[model samples]
Target: MTVQPIIFFPDQRLKQICAPVIEFDNALRTLTVDLLDTLRAAPGIGITAPHIGINQRVVLLDLPQSNMPEIYINPEITWLSDNKKQNEEGSISMPGISAPVERSVTIRFCYTDLYGKEHTEEADGLRSICLQHEIDQLNGIFWIQRLSALRRTRLLTRYKNI
Candidate 1:
């Protein structure tokens, strides 16, 4: 597997809802590997298939706490806590700019692994934020959409300058 070029912001593909991964095969495994490589190259903690222009519900997160990258396919949020917290968020697709976005402080989500095994997990803090952010990408909601209009405009202006 090789690192693929990231699809930059404003790309229509980034806004298109990704199709669920129906098959668990070599192709899916390769895509996961490529995603991991690209995420590492982008030096990002998390990335979605759409970030690389793939219309598939796949995400890879390489958090420092994990021994290796974690892959999630067809992930969906199952529960969100009433508590909220703000964290700086950015995207590999939209490099160079980030804005603080408020998200549920705790969340429960379900996803399929590369082997097609379904799993549910709970997260809090940065992990909670990352899961929600990447899941948004899968649903065709770019992270910026979570920002206020003024904040989004300012972030886009800064991105343009970069």
Candidate 2:
């Protein structure tokens, strides 16, 4: 597996709504492994295929303290909790910028495995946050978009100067 280069913020590909994974082929499998390697190398807990300019609805997450990475292909959130939580969020695309983004404290989502098997599961805490974050990326939503206008401006300014 290769460590793919992450696309930076302001890249048009990062803003695209990724297409669903239709064929579970060797290329898709390779992309999944490459995504995991790239995310680990970036030292981020979560990532999406769009982060590397691939317009596919795929997400990978390795929550803190977890030994194995979780792969979600063509994932969709089916349910979301009323409760909300604020977690510090960052993106590999937009390094040196992070903010507390409010999101559902729990979520239920369905996804396909590399072998084309489907699974549904619920998540809470950091796992919940990571899933929501990565899913948003699959939907063309950037983490910075979760911030208030003022906060977003400040962060972008700071990141620009860095």
| lDDT, candidate 2, 57-108, per-residue tens | 9999988778898889999999999999888999999988889999999999
With a 3 Å backbone cut-off (N, CA, C), the pairs that clash in candidate 1 are none
Instruction: List runs of model 2 lying over 4 Å from the truth.
Output: none
Best by TM-score: 1
- The clash count of every prediction, one per candidate, is 0, 0
Query: lDDT tens string, model 1, 95-126?
Result: 88888999999999999999999999999988
lDDT of 1: 0.93
- Model 1 stretches with alpha carbons more than 4 Å out: none
lDDT of 1 at 141: 98
Report lDDT (Cα) of residue 36, candidate 2: 89
* Model 2 pairs in collision: none
